[model samples]
Target: MMPLRNPKHAPAAAAHLSRSAGVRHQGTKRSLSAQRSPAAQRAAPLNLEIEQLREKGNAAFKAGSYSIALQHYQEAQGKALTCRPVDDDLQARILSNCAAAQLHLGQPQAALQSCKRALQAVPNHTRALGRAVTCHLRMGGFSAAQGFIDALRAQPLTQAEANTCQQSKDALQALVQQALARAAKAATAEEGVQALAALEACLEDSHAPCMPSLLLTKADLLLLLDRHQDATRMVLAASEAAGWPQERLERYSKWVHAHMLYSQGQLDKAATAVSEMAEAAADDECRPAPALLPSRSAFAMLQQAEPQAFRDLAQSLTMLHQAKEEGNNAWRRQDKAAALNFYTHALEGITAPPPVFAAVVFASRAAVHRADGRLLDALADSLRSLALCPLYMRGVLRLGQLLTDMGRHELAAQELGALQKEQAAAARAHAVNATCIDLWRDVDAALKKAKEGQRQRRAIDHFEVLGVPRTLCTDDEVKKAYRQLVLKFHPDKALGRCRFSSAIHTTCRPSLAQSQLEERVRAQAHRVFSMISDASTALATRSSRITLEAQLNVAQYRTASQQQPYSPGRYSGAYQPRSSTARASRQNAYSKTYSNDYYDSDYYAYERFWAS
Candidate 1:
């Protein structure tokens, strides 16, 4: 006889049926031996063999050796069948176990066949019904799975089995929808192909959201047909909708925006974007579409048009601004050399700066010059700043202050007075708010000081102050004159005199007012001492003397038109000039000698030559 297959639970149930059959045979063989049927007698030994086989199968199944377990269960089922009468319930369970083992072995077809037999043996078998539902769902039999589900739900079930049945039903419905969606997608693809074919047949115009492949193919077809312009347009549109073309569009928009910012003079923002774009270009993304490339577009017209070059410019500008900031901080700390170095670096870094930024830097550098008493250089820078940006208030104020310090007080007064009037008029006409109120106050004070200085002006030539002629004085003569004067007006001599006066007045305990008056006198002495010191320093060198002589002549000419007369001071009486004929000859020779070769410290190597 052919062996019957078993599945899960078959081994345990068969083992139990064999034990009960053994008990009945034991009672019959002992108490009713003569009356016992031959078949019953034969079934007793078969029952014992079935029990042993069932135990081994159960162990194999528990150990996860499903093939071995299935074999043992099959043998047990065969032995059970050879008994006098078969247990229908036991037969159903063993067949269900066989289906389970087949399911685990990935033979759903065979498992389903075993399940049908199990259901036939006991029509209301729950395990067989559940297993059959799973097999149909796995095979994509939605309708068949639904039939099994309905049958599963009708049977009496535990909570877990009922939940599993509901899950299977849900899965079946979802699979049906998925199949339908896949079919519709396939149809759509076919329709797209047909539409392209029809367009090719018509040889006419068309226009998605369509796949890039289809669009590219259409573009090629148009090209082959010699519709060059249409082909180009189609290619552009397709690129705009897909691939690297979309990325190019975004990049192009950013470039345009940055260009606009640059045009509006928003340098920092535009440069920052250029730097970020350059960094992003290092990625492995495709090159921009040829038509959208900057070199092929209007963006190429911008300054520093290449992406890498623009990024370099941005970095350069950032460093320049940082230097400018450092210069400003150094100036605030009163570090003149450090401030000048940083400002010079900032200026040298940019070959062409925006006029507004250049104007501001120039004015700041002029402030450094004015503080160092290089009035000619200060004047030049301040004027250049104003030339670059005529409305720069700080530059205007610096120019006024520089002129006053240079003793062109009348001119300083005139320029500042004009600026004050112009600003007031502008404020009235344009309703322009005064943003530089403090600056205006400073300008007002400078104008007042210039007017006062103009009234009491003394034409004290630096050369004359050192008891030397304007021209033809040798460095030795200049040095000799400076030493002779230093003995009288040196800071050390002035301090000693101040101490002597204070000691003399100490016996009389001077009041606060008297102390303040003494302090003012000392301050006035130091001021004169500094002026004498600067005069000596300027006249000590031939180059500086030449430069200063040129500056003085310019100042004299400026004052000559005003007809300002020179007033004799205490030092003026100490100086005597050479004969007029000799002086005149030397002056003429000096003018001709250094006129073209003179260098301005503001632009040339003033510090290097000065140090030497």
Candidate 2:
């Protein structure tokens, strides 16, 4: 008789049972059937062992002992895959679990590959997709990460799963917005202070990540603000707190120290520091040493031979490329959210730049706004670029596009005609071609339609934005509504990580989502309560009189020059000359005597002496 396979390892049998269903083992008769096949008999014991190991791994993972869980998971994977041919579903599950473990272990690249494999095995596996999204996000593959987020959301999610997804989405959104704001600030010549102020606010927010990288960013901004001491302090503090690998910390600190030295005109010491930093950076694995070539070259040319200048420049370039690639990818994916994030990142990456660089950054931002269907924003950015660099063709083209979209066809046509004339004057045949004319006409017509649509939409007012009733709203009620609206539509809350439940909890907890959402809501409510308490005194003062008083004694002083002398005379011989001082003293005595007599009279009787 043929040997029977172990039913325990059969996915087909497992599929028939619900995940929570109990498994019952048949007795010795079935045990004997397993023993008939040498492979089955041998695999049965290993499969049982693997199952036990998997359970232990899961238990450890739940307890947050990820390292121990990883060991068990790795062992289980080895035993199960070698012991028998696992089904596709089981294989995918194993890969997904392995990827999760790797992610917790901080091996994102390995985790990404594992997740990809898992998804290949089971394309619709939510766990695999989630893991992939997280890994891609960590890797800075933002477009891919966003795509995965969308895909995950499209699937049916349990309440718990949905909450987790929402949290991740919120975190990504916050990061992207922060990156963009930084980019926009960096692109502007005069907005550094405003940007730093905003950045400081972000730093002050306890919930924000205060990582060393972010601190380094602040230090860079501080340097721009000519707050050298503050910048140095920040850099040193960041170096100490980075907790990165030794090489990374050393590389970062060396460059920062070198820059400080160079700024102080310690050229020889700065050069030495720069050399050391270059050597250390060469060996650093976290970031590529070769990628520092352009910066290193530039630093070599500095009058002071300061390596940090080169390093900063190189970092900026790398960040710029990263942002551009990310934005382009997001655009390709048609992910407006991700595209906007990356576009902002790209804009922020420009630190020191020529005027044309600003034009490029603005142009890219306009494109992002255009993609987002925010025509006004797009027009604003494009116009800003044109104002900065009037000769920038891209900005002009984008502005024309925005104008055409806004139904300002006459303006668009004029812009297009100017562009054509400029190009034709330069003998550029391609620039003033039929395609340009066609695009101009099409855009002009579209703009007219868009203007009509906008007119229709513009009929709504501010009250409509908050969906609030306009009838008889009291001052108190209006103030309350405004606060709610601010919390709801404040760009930061809308575009970044405003805890949703917190808004609900503070505004109206009963309407919030159940489970984990309640916790955030309650926290938000507590925050709101504190704010309300703090404002109560001011609010009360609005309708009431409040006074504060302090009593202070006034001291009177007489200078020697102003002092009077009694019985003083310059000459005396029976013909006595009465000094002015003596006359004044006599008058004072007479006045005092008369004043007492007057006070004794009933005219001022029993009145209290009041001091003002």
Candidate 3:
């Protein structure tokens, strides 16, 4: 060997080696690579470059610069792999350091890969094994973590490393305990799917054989989920599935057997069956640390109390079914009377039957009544049915028919149209198997006809209410009329000055009825004041005034079509003015002047209090 030259050449190799040759490698009497082959000598740094890189990586890692630390570690790992001996402690240390950085960076999967390579180089590498355990735990690979933890613990460790091993074991145990607790909670919460999922998740992970305890819990949770067969398969192991050892299988059998007995409705037998198992588990110091089963007295109380609830529920259900059967039979035979009676009985039988069943009875009775041509009764029942279940297709169909029978075709069609959307949504969500296409087609046809036949209700004439001419009014005219009316009727003006007639003291000189009458008059005055306020609001703006004018024209046209022509001349001698403004002023004085008219005192008395 020609005394292998340093692989790295500085600006001046001779000067660099002269200074560093003794200083960097000074502690060693003989170089660790003194007798290495030329290839081995060239593969690693001769000076201290790798140590420098590790120092920089540590600094970056400690500074919360995870990404920078990761880059530094990766570079160190690359150099060590390519430049150092394959099985050197330095090679394992660099790879394990890379894994620690990766773990902290939230790249546990990547960290596992690095740890595996480190372990390959040095099988007893405690740091690498511990890092691998952490990575597995991070990824929910409890089985894989257990293997690393066990392997790590098997190796000789310093006091600190031993503590690390203990901590790792405790962490893995805590994970097992938490998963079990969560599974138990989910089961008790009646979240069956989630409970089964939690069990299947733990059972499927073969590498992280958390403990015999988790597997036992899986069997119990499976039973709780009503998965008798899966519970059996999990505990006994299927033909195609890998089985647990015989001793372990025996430990799982106690819970599985008790679950089977429980499934047969043998509550007492099930409770007794699991008692020994729980006791034995507690004896073994198993986690979550088993608690004793409920005592016999608790079981007795449950057994005593459960029957009354079950009987009440069963009786109601049975009576409802009986009523429904009678209705169905009567309906099929065209006995509308009998069917109506039976359906009514079914509807009234339960105080609160399930909404679905109640809706069915209501709709069924409505259909019977519809066939009998009692449209009002049918409408009542159909409305009740829809109230119970807005999405009840039968109720929707019946309600539309009932409404159509009642000559409310537009409302009938609108209601059915709304149901069409609900049906389509139900079908899309897979909540209903029947497609809504046919129903929508029928509803759309009905809606088109109903729209054409729809009676356009005339808008209430605010112009008449405010005593203004429909066509002659300007914004100022409307506002002026509104102000005069509100002034006459405003509760504030009438509150203290108003007088009550003797007729208001109906039963006595001043009885309870008289007080009530006084309050009623005050209420009436407030209401008239509100109406005057509403009139003001209606004509407050130009757009609103225009809308009011159009409404008054339509109302007048409708009134003219329905009645004989009004005679302005016939009422002229009795005195009505041309302009509504002049006419409105007379009407405003009508209330105040006639406040003393005293005609049909019983009827005219309350009017003297407001409306000027």
Candidate 4:
């Protein structure tokens, strides 16, 4: 028989069932004399059919068709229950498989009930016990799970089973540790107490190795709540369980004593005792780790007890700096996700914003954003970092590089050019160092590349820029297209510039400082406006138009020869076919009335004609 809940046996079972089905369809019934017994004959076909359904369910589960797999398991179980003198082992296996499918579908409670039913059929089912332990752990019933875990341990198990059970335990501990940490950071006492109670409920089973961490967390919470005696007791118990020596226990004892004195309004005595503890903690062997001291909550209490001893601003900055270093290390390890989280923590940890540190972390996060293909977010972060610390060299370089990659050559050039001037000023003020010289070279190289991109952009086809056909356009058409483009792209009329100007007039009111982003957008609009003007000039006049037309024909013919057969399209510069009657009528009308007023009248009439 196939192993319980094993999908690997599916193909062989399917093949065997197919052969049997084919024989049954061929009317190969056993003679009465050849049959074993009436009961065996009556039960034989039902058992075979149930096995076939179970195998089908296994195949579906392996194929990731979990809903279909679940339906098959339920149908197989239903059929199995209908048989007289039921096959207990087969029923247990089917129920266990149903549990596995339920678990995969994220129905933990349902899966747990299925496991119970399976175990009811066969009391010592190993697979059912293992799955039940998992369901209980997932539902945060760790104490309830202990019974299943012990039962599974009592059974002889294979190496795979042991490894899986160990992994589940590890996962549970990690989850509990995370929960306790969150409780420690809870904003209100009521919230923290509730969180702690939930954690305690889940952790009633002493077999979990994470109990020491939990005890320490509870001590920290109790201390914050001014339950001095309970906090001290928890600290002592946690210290012993965590294998802390005499020195660490004494330090926490002193801290708890000082906290108690502070809570009872003996401020002077609390100050003296805290000073003594601090002096003792200065000794290298006696120093406690910052996390172990649980100072964030106590630090708040101490502010009222001893104002001169702790500065909140300095403490917050120290924590943010540590987070920044961790972020840098994660970035070095190429773990962008971890690096992003650490940088965000540093940003949020500050009590008073430190410009330099904030700028550095923002710039580092921008680098991660760039690596993850979030170019717009990278651009925003880079600009924000530069706005915070204008002279931050790395931030300037990053923003310039980003602009260049986005084909905003004019903006890239401006950024790099400013850096070049700064580098030159520094070199003149002092002896030129290697670092300064290297930065100068990078700025110079980036500026040159940006200028090259600008030149390339200018060299693109004028007809393409104005959205007019070189082969079919007349002088009037060229002028009209140029006017429309100028209206669309002019700095004064541009969409972004208009919106910003509106804001300045309304809610923004008058302010001495303008947003850096608005300035960049205005500059970009002016650059595009200038490019359009230059393109218009290059295509103006009769001689210029004829020269452009001849040049375009040669380029198009050469391109068409090397590529696929060209059709009459924009790039090919070929004219679309025109009707002879329409061309003749247009020519006759133009010849008879060729005046500016006549053209203006026709234009307005055509506009009115379209409106109707």
Query: Which structure among the candidates has the greatest TM-score?
Result: 1
Q: Give the lowest summed-lDDT range of ten residues in model 2.
A: 547-556
* True-structure lDDT of candidate 2: 0.48
Candidate 3 residue 82 Cα shift, in angstroms, is: 49
Clashing pairs in 4: none
Taken over the whole model, the C-alpha lDDT of each candidate is: 0.55, 0.48, 0.53, 0.60
Worst 10 residues of 3 by lDDT: 503-512
lDDT assessment of candidate 1: 0.55
Estimate, for each residue in 519-546, the C-alpha lDDT of model 1 and write its tens digit. 4435545654565677877676777776
Please give the clash total of every predicted structure, in order. Answer: 5, 4, 7, 0
Cα lDDT tens digits, model 4, 1-612, are 011111223233222322321212121133532322344445545578888899999999999887799999999999998888775656777887887777666555676788899888777665676666655544445656656655644344467655664566566666676766666566555666776676666455423322455666677676655577998987776665444667767877777776566334343455466556545544454544444433244423322323233333224335655687899999999999999999888766423233445666778888998898665456656765676567878788888876676556788889988988888788789957788678677778888877876765522456655656765466788789789878767677533322211110121111112244345545655656675686688778645654565555544454455577755674675544556676567556644644443344434443333233
Candidate 3: regions farther than 4 A off: 1-153, 156-322, 344-355, 369-391, 405-410, 419-449, 452-612
lDDT of 3 by residue, 177-275 (tens): 666666555523245457556655654442233233445455445555546577666455321112233443444454455445533333344445544
Best by lDDT: 4
The best-first sequence of candidates by lDDT reads 4, 1, 3, 2
Cα lDDT for residue 408, candidate 3: 58
TM-score each candidate.
0.34, 0.29, 0.31, 0.29
